[model samples]
Target: MPLLWKTSILLAISHDSNILPAHLQPLPSRGGHIRWNWIGDEHLNKTTDIIYMNASVAADGTLTGVSDFRATKFNGVTWLKTHAGREGVFAFKGPKAFMSIPGIVLPQDLKTFTFEASYAPQGAQNAELIRSGDFRIAWKGDTLSIQNGANTYQGSIPAVPAGQWVQLGCVVKEGIPSLFVNGKAVALLPGQSQPLTSIGNATLIGSGYTGMMDELRVWKEARPATRLGRDISPTWADRLLYFHLPADTKRSMGEDKASWASQIAWIRSRLRNPADHMVRLGIAGGAWKDMLRDPKARQKFAGEIASIVNRYKLDGVDLDFEWIEGPYKGDPPARQWDNYADLAQRIRKAQPDMCFTISLHVVCYRMPKKGIDAVDYFTFQNYGPSSARYPFDDFTRSLAAFRKQGFPDSKIMLSVPFQGTGDAKADSVRLYSDIVAQHPNLPPTADTAEFTYPDGTKRKMTFNGPATIRKKCEYAKAQKLRGIMYWDMGGDVRTDARKGQTDYRHPKALLPVINEILKGRR
Candidate 1:
């Protein structure tokens, strides 16, 4: 038997005076046999009309309906129903419907089910109107089949059609369930199955009935047909949980050289306890300059990073070096690139087991390919004016360009910005909260930068929200790309040159969302 989540009842009817009675009961605590009363009013009398009751149950049980006046008792250990009212009352009515409990003979377990009962259309009207317009059924797995009125049908999974009253049944036998329409086989499942147990709920019935259901039975047996009724896919929530880092930890450091060190500490703290998904520590841009300036400084930085690995520990290190001043600057000042390469090579040598990353700008025309090849992962900073205009195409082309330079997809990282900027003056150089407090004209979207082209045309660039980021991540995954990294972590903070004070705003805002996307859970 498979684990069951929850059971529900759906009733659709048109008549005004129709009353559907419901009886609620408790599920049995221990595994054992149980019994219940299956009684209903016998006043039902209508021609060419179908009537039935629907109930939710857990565990396997029998429902025996006894006609008191007629002294006729129909006992069904599986699933049962009728087309008209009772046998002989309506000759034009369809069959005396009784469906068997889907056999439970498979080897695996089942998870979900959908069932429905419906009324099939008659003649040209039936063909044009859509067959099985009204039907009712319940399932423990994917699909169900049922019959009602003058028509029979392959019922819809999860929901039956309106206007027809048909009893639908679904059961999980081992790992499969079979669906039957009007006692005839309709669908089968070789793998999917859901355990059928008792759900303490009343059975639904008649006229107002979207579709009639009565003498509905649930058993430990499997119904193969139900698995064909619907599709089952895993949800984002189902992937499991992973923590990136604390808000304060991610925010406390700014775009300064020390932010990388702080971030390393933060990542170590997060990795103290392992989770299902992997955790990453990103050292923002500008930090590389601090590491390269002095030999003593370089050693200290490396030592601290190694301590981070030894202490809280980490999966990898992300290199975000925005120090390259652009192509027009010519040759990139030589020593800067050398120092950058040295830092990367050292990190790789020290932590060969870790993922060594370097954040490089996306100017393929000007970027030094040799410097990029030193790191385990090279994240291209796809922000600024060049990226805003041709976002997707430009990024794809740039990735291709990197591959042409001998950089594999697994070695590349896509760095997108979460903050936006427009006018240098209007842009909040500080935290968002501080920006809000100081600059009254600044809008939530104003912080994003807007770039101006050589032709004097301007385009606005905003940080992508979770949805867009998720799509981008998916695209990257599909391309077999390495991973994603972002620009300066503290770009949202407000800085005051006069007082020399800084405030990190929205530090926790985007990191979690990014982590979620990377883990394929967003």
Candidate 2:
């Protein structure tokens, strides 16, 4: 699961019957064998068609798919288990080894589309990574090539380094085809006029590619070049198929079996008033300091940010400068606090109509007041030890620290963690969903849950349960704060099933608790 922050969760209803329901939206893509299960009478029939973005495999060797379609392994394509906390990767034993999937239909127009995957080559060789109908995505030695009828090209994409996990994507938007490697657009080919689909559209993955392929996805729409290849867990909405080629290994992030994009689309389609809810894109990166340090680049970058905000019709932008106190990579400027402030000011100037907010740790008290005043609100990262070791004390002390630093009370949003802190020497934070799934009868007020492993090692996870989350919401309301904030919607206990799968909203979920405390039940 990818980490996203939100100040609030609001609902709306869509009235139009003409719109295709979100779950019914076509996703002709491919990935691992994990399934995304949906709960609710309205979704029972649509669940079979849901498109999942995250990928995970079943450990029992049985291909368990939530969708009606299935993946068939052919010619010695085997599973390779990796170290604990990582998904089990697929191993292509020889040239003939591959995985075949039926029912992946590319758009008839083929004017725009995207095909992408993650692969680690055992050695350099000409290999076909994806083949279906007349479309062929292959690697001619280190160069990625595509052969779709006569509209074909080779070496347009930069040479892919051998023996490393590289994410490769081909995005054909508006008749022009571009190649993206590791999130950056590397090459482009002449436009094609023919349909990209074939009559018999079964997809074969990894014939002649003697390597591991994972996190595969195909989409009818060309993914935004600026947005592709950035996050491993991009939402699956218009995609045809999505698969993660490995099994869970007790990691903090759960499987990407559910169609988050479809769920959101369905929710949005049913909204009574769209203005009641909003979606903000979070922006953060180390390279941002350099862009902001120079005046010319800063203005241009700010404009680009605004373009994204306006073009997508996003409600706002959230600034998450993680390296505010940095001599990043031991570069010059030991503290880039001023640069961070400048960035906020620049983006604010560019996109004044859109809401602007920033997320900061307690160490950011020293950030210039100029930067502090540029945004609409401030979200304090109040759940961790550097803020305070004790739970309730941490919240209060962290707020006081920011208050002392002069952040306005009305613009302050208190933070809550749906995932547990690593009190049990856990390698990663434990999701609230996993905690409740493992301990269904655990007390709602109990903020800590301990588990014993097979080796008799005991570890305790500290997190906010329904009771704790409610208390925090109430506290924020009492303090007259702007609102409460949480790291993600994915971490809350959203399903009733105990298999630790699916993405449906359960009654005991944390968001509902927050809603009850903050807004009163509808």
TM-score of each model, paired residue for residue: 0.35, 0.53
In angstroms, give how far residue 10 of model 1 lies from its true place. 48
Output the number of the TM-score-best candidate.
2
The positional error of residue 118 in candidate 2, measured at the CA in angstroms, is: 16
List, residue by residue over 1-522, the lDDT tens digit for candidate 1.
110000000000011112111111111100000011111111111000111111111111111110111101222211222334421111111122221112121111223232322332111111110111222333322333232222233434433343333434444333234465544554642332223233222112221212223322222234345332222112111111010111112232111111223322322233223232132343442234444655555555555555555554455544434645543224444566665566566666666686455546666322345555656555565655432522566667777777776677766666545444442332322222223333445443343444443346565544444445456555665676665544323222333312222232233233334444444321
TM-score, cand. 1? 0.35
Model 2 / residue 166 / CA error / Å? 24
Query: Cα deviation in Å at residue 400, candidate 1?
Result: 3.2
lDDT of 1: 0.33
lDDT agreement with native, every candidate? 0.33, 0.54
Residue 61 lDDT in candidate 2:
16
- In model 1, the number of clashes is 69
